[model samples]
Each structure stands twice: as C-alpha cells, then as structure tokens.
Target: MRRSPWSTLVVLAIAQFMVVLDVTIVNVALPRMQTDLGFAPDDLQWVISAYTLIFGGFLLLGGRSADLVGRRRIFVAGLVVFALSSLAAGVATSPLELILFRGVQGLGGAMLSASALTLLMVTFEHGRRRTIALGVWGGLAGLGGTMGAIVGGVLVDNLSWRWVFLVNVPIGIVVIAATFFIIRESRAIISGRRTFDVAGAVLSTTGLLAIMLGVIRAEPLGWGSIEVIGLLAGGVLLLAAFVLVESRSAAPLIPLRLFRTRSLSLSVVALGLNSAGFLAMFFLTAIFLQQVRGLSAFDTGLAFLPMGIAAIVGAVVASRFVTMFGTRAVQVVAAVISVIGLLLLSTADASSPYASSLLPGLILFGLGITAMGVPAQVAAQSKVRTDDAGAASGVLNAGYQVGGALGLAVITTLATAHITDAMTGGTAPLAAAVGGFQFGLLIAAIFAAVNIVIALLSPSVTVDSATATEAAELEPVAI
Candidate 1:
C-alpha cells in the first residue's frame, strides 16, 4: 500500500523547514564563528553571502532538474549533500573552509527546497486538499526563518556555535531515511524528445549568481562601485539573453508561456514583495533588540516567541479564509494588517519596553506576514500545469530570495544614511541608531503596503477548472 499523502507532506515539510531555517540561523552565531575561525571583520560577511549567493543563484536550475530527473531522486541526493556539508561546516578549522562548506550547503538547499515543493504539488490533488497542503508548507517555511533566531541562540548559548551546523545531521538522516519508506518517485511526462535546456539553465544560473552577489556586496562595497555595477549590469544582460533563448527553444527550462498565466504571474510578484517586507522586518528587529535595547542573543530570541505563535495562528486562519473568500480578498486584508503592524513597530525607540511597544507590533507583523504569505503561495500554485509545476515553483522561490536580498540591501543603506545624518546633527550614537532603525521599519511598512495592489491585481477566484486538469496530469510512481 502507498503511504498517505499527509505522511509525505510531513516528510517534505520537515526537509523544507530545515532548509529555510538555515537562511537565518547563523545570524546569532556569527560572532562566535568569526572568533573561533579567525575571520577578519570585512570577510565575516562571506559566511552568509556565500550561502545566499549559491542557493538563490541555482534555485532555477535545481527546480527544473526536479522535473527532468526524478523528484524523489533529486530530493534524496540533496539531503545527502546538505547533511554532509553541514557536518563539514561545523568541523571547519578555518573561515575559508566554513564559507566553502556553507556554499556547498546552499547548493543542496536549492535542490531540496525545489523538489520538496514539486513533490507536494504533485502529491496533493487540486482543491481544498492542495490549498491546505500549501498553507502548511508556506507556514512552516515562514516560521523556519523566524525560529532560526531562537534555535541559533539556544544552540550558541548552551552548546557551541558549531551546533548550529551540526544540528542538521540527525534531522537530515532521519528525513532521508523516511523519504525512502514514505515518498514515491515522480517526474513530469514529456511527449517529445527529453532534452534539457542546457543554454537556458546556464544563463539563468550565472545571471542570478551575479545578481545575488551584487546585491549582497552592495552594502559593503556601495552600489556605485565598479564591481557592483558590473555584476548587476552583466546579470541583467544575461537574464535578458536567457529570456530570448527561452522563447526560441523547443524545450525551455522555463516556458515563456507560463508568464501569460495571470494568476501565477501576479502571485509570484506578490510573494516576492511579501518576502521583501517580511524579511526586512526580521533583520531590522533583530538588530534593534540586540544593539539598541542591549538584549542578549538568547533574550532576543525569547522575545520573538510571541510573534512565532501569532504567525502560526495567522497561517491557519489564512488557509481557511482563502477557501471561504478567495486569495485576492485574504491577501489584501492581510497585507493591510501587516502595514499597520510595521507602522506600529516604527514608533519604537531604544527606551521602548517589549511588552508595551515591541510585543504588539511583533504579534501583528508575524500574523499579517504569514497570513499574507499563504494566500500568495496558494495563488501562485493554483493555476500551474503539472509538468510546469517545478519550473513555476522555482521562479516563485527565486522571486522570494531575490526580493529579500534587494529589500535588505535597500533598507540597510537607507538606515545607514539616516543614522549618519542623525549623528551629524548631534544626536547621541545610541539615539541615532534607534532613529535609523525606526526609519528602516517605516520603509519596511511601505513594502508591505505595496502588496495590497498586487493582491488586488491577482485573480479573483481561487479554484478553477484548469486546476483539475493540472491535477489529472500528476501520478506517483513507486521505485
């Protein structure tokens, strides 16, 4: 007998959680890792950048691979690579080794994340079941990022910073083993010659790499720097070439026609903007709590617990509401809530108390962001063809990563300038920093507000006849 679809979802969710958690888990442990590995201050950023660059860069390729190759095969392969890299990263004696291992870990993450989503999409039939599954997937993914701070802080405080990386070993092993017993292999059925879009993959991967690299370095090197400008410009040109090639190729990595699907296209844009605002809030708040309020990493993590709870509630609520009302309505209402949350957060200062000032905003922001995310994700997958599911999911995921990088880069730059102005105006250093963060929070609020328009533009209906057709095309194959 086959395993339950819910059982497969559990396995995939666990793996996806592990991958997304790594995106921010290292934030609290960076100092410890730097000191232990003898990292220069300037070079310390590489530990984060390397992973982001590689993971975001290769996501498109990884997702498409899931379609061409077997999804289960790619998923298992990703787990092994990720687990081994995590082990090596934890044991590294030098900064270079750690960074190298982290980059490799990112490659594994790209594969694992993309295939996991494909498996979920193909496993669940369209309608309420798929919506619920997507909600669970989206919620866990969002929570993973928030929980990273808590998990990292606990590990670094109780054990060593190495535990942050090493913790994945057992989890990965269990997930990999469970996959063999529970999940069946599945691949898209191609009618013509099974040719991979080699040219499209290369162009898109390298182009995205260049873009991520440019964005990551912009804060340090300045956007106007020759290196940053060259990388960004080159990435744009390469992506343009990739688009051109895709239009001509018989078997494109990403079908240009997918963009014509209004629901899918709009949902992707909405998700990207959702990530931009949502992630920037987390980044800014972490710094605000640690630097301005002088909270220890552990304490800062504890303070975020309420927000995590709120997010869980929001996720559940969004899933139900979308079924009752539709994605467009839920998204708009949820985003409005997020805008309010961020605006409330912007009023906080160094002297603001957690209970009175920070807690309320955190609760609202978490709820709104997660609620907003679920619908956006559901809408994106709602109209996708089964054969195109992997590619569409890849673009959706890539949009989230790239949008986040852009948000952080832009918000950080703006905050820095604000702080500089405040310091120059004779504000004390601590006060200036607070003011800058407050301003940054305001900008994040703006980003959240933009999602309202995207939500409005999204397809009005959630379930369509096309969804049933898509579901008909998917079937599970036992190995």
Candidate 2:
C-alpha cells in the first residue's frame, strides 16, 4: 500500500519553529540592541512591537492570500523575504534601520505563519496522520518561545545581537530548499474571487496597531492622557467598522460566520491569554533576570529550561489527555494551573533566589502551560470546512500574535507605571522595576483566570465540526 501524500513535516516544523523562536530570540538581545542603537528607554518597545504588529496585522491577508494563490508558492516566497529581512536587520547600524528591517522581517513572518499550518493541514488527511502531524506542529509552538531565549542568550553572550537575526539566514535557506523539493503545490478549494477584502484588512490592522500602541504608550503617556484615550477610541471605532464591513462584503477577509463555533470562539479567547502569559513571561522574565537581578543573558536563558521542557512535555501529554477527559475539562484545568504559576511569579523579586523563589513558579507554570497547548489548538481548528481551514487557523494565529502584542504593551506599561510610582524619594529604582514586573505578572494571572472561565464554557466532548463558522459557537457548548 502506498503512503498518504504528506509534505515533509520535518522541514515544515523546523521552518515554523524558526518563525516562533524569532519572536523571543531577539528579546535576550534587547539590551544589546538598545545600547548599540542608542534607543531611548521608552522608544524600545518598537523593537519588539515592530515584528508582532506586522505579523498580527497581516496574518489574515497572508492566510487568505495563500488560499487564493497557492500555499507552496507563498510559503517559499515568505521564507526568501524573511531571510533577506533578517540579514538586513542583523547588519543594521542604527536603531531606525533595525526597526525598519524588523518590520520587514515581520512581513515575511506574517506570510510564512499565515500559510504554514494550512499547508500542513492539506498535506495530512484527517485521523491518525493529522494527529501525529499536529503533535509535531504543536510541540514547535511550545518549544519556540523557550528555545529562542535559550539561543538568544547563547548568541548574545558569545557573539553579538546580530547573531540572533543572522542565525535565521542559514535556517531559512535550508527550509526553502527543502520545501521546494519535498512540498507539492496545492490549489485553493475555491478560486478567483472578484476582490480581496482590502478595506477590511486596512481597518482591522490599523485598529489593532492603534490599540497596541495605546497600551504600550499608556506607561509613559499615562492611561488618562488624551493620546491613550484617543487611540483607544479610534481603535475601537475602526474595529467596529471592520466588523460591519466584513458583514456587508461579498468576499470578507474573515468570514464573520466562523465565530459561530463555541469551541473556536472560546478557544480564541483562551489562546489570547495563552499567548499573553506564555510569550510575555519570556520577555518579562528575561528583562527582570538580567536588569533587576543582575543575571547574565546566559543565566536567564538557562533558568528558562525548566519551563520550556515542561511546555513541550505538557503539550505532548495534552494530546493524550484531551482524547480522554475531553478538551473543555483539560483546558479549564490548564487555565487554573497556569494562573497559579503566574500568581507564583507575582512573588518574584530582585533579591529572590532562583531555587527558592523563581524555580517553583516556572515549573508549575510550565505544567499548566503544557496542558493548554493541545486544547487551544484543537478548539481553534476543530470545526470548519477544509477549504476555510487556513482562514480559521489564521484567526487563532492572529489572536495569538495580537494577544502577545497586547500583552507586552499592557504588562510593560503597567509595570513601568508601578515602578515609576513606587520610586518616590530615592527609593531603589531597580527594586521598584522588579516589583512592577510582579504587578504585571499578577495582572496576567487575572487574565488567565478569565481564560479558565472561558474554558469552562467549552464542552466535555469534542465539538461537532459541521457548524464551526461562528466564533463563539463551541463556547456555549462548554458551559
């Protein structure tokens, strides 16, 4: 008997991991980037936000474009563009140049990310094949954040920040070559739509940028400032308009009907927290370990091993767990577990010992995070037609990316505010910074608790795949 025609999972997983790892790898390099480029403390968020904003903003369009054009072609194109952008970013001499190149890199990431999973889904037929492939895929998601930090620390400590971006150069080339050789072109289920949803895309992306900027800037600008208030209002209005436009359009960027699924809807909200807590923790922990606790990049990265290993093991474990007690139950428990970890993290301080203080929190957080991997992925893509699968997955991907962007902005702003406020009259500013980080992590824990409630709304069994269009369709079933 002939084997099913599956694309190269190894190449795809490696490519996808590169994209995900890039998200955090640069973080360990942030201090170096800031010093070399002479970036102001306040202006530094751009370095991080540059990639995420573009990635989140363009994800839907990228995903839809793959369906309209061809996944293999788009995926390869994305890799080439991403590789070039990495080179440009690595060699950048000025802060402005780095930010510009980072944005370009983000564009490529958006394109690659939007289509990678779609290709995988198409490559593997449903059932056992799909299950194994997805496990590998999900493991990448768990490992990416941790590995990025690990690699970033090693690179930044040994070579330079440039190495962080430069590392992608070779990896990208290899993935592209392998993709061409091992991957086959797959046509979109439906083709030749009259017009793309350009207007909706513009509105949605602009709105998201406004919101993220507002959140990030609220630290310096103050939440009550007109800039924050105006951006928030504008973002809300633009997003509302995006929704209205999507409803009226003949060819919508996001088929609003996808929200109809309870599982998909709730999973998105869950993923938002997952992305926020998981990714943001990496950023915050790295900064806190080095800046406040006076640890080196290598030390900070080494500290993350426990959490990283746990996330991968947990995700693999979750695949088996979800098949038994069902997704909803596993997710609810996962949320609670992660929340506990965040709560533990809130107790972290500049003077805290790695073993007595940070280790327990990271280990527990890793365990809970491990639980969320499968359910969130499954719920997000459980339903929907195979044709719309790319779009559907892109929705969750956007949520994940956008959520991380928002998390960085919101948590960073809150921490900054708390630190500034606490540093009255010559108080130790560094300690204040650590305290601020704790405050931010606490807020993240609260956010995850909301995820727990959302997960509780899911069902004890797998959702039916027929009516997966509605965003909140599967959510109601969980309750």
Which one wins on lDDT?
1
List the lowest-lDDT window of 10 residues for candidate 2: 470-479
RMSD values for the candidates in order, in angstroms, are 5.0, 4.5
Question: In lDDT terms, how accurate is model 2?
Answer: 0.76
Alpha carbon deviation, residue 202, candidate 2 (Å): 2.4
Clashing pairs in 1: none
- The lDDT per prediction is 0.77, 0.76
At residue 379, candidate 2 shows an lDDT of 68
In model 1, which runs have C-alpha deviations exceeding 4 angstroms?
A: 1-10, 30-53, 92-100, 120-146, 177-186, 212-225, 381-390, 420-428, 462-479
Q: What TM value does model 1 have?
A: 0.83
The residue-by-residue lDDT of candidate 1 on 302-415, one tens digit each, is 887887788767766776777678878988998999899899889988886778888898899878877777677677777779867666766766766656655665666677
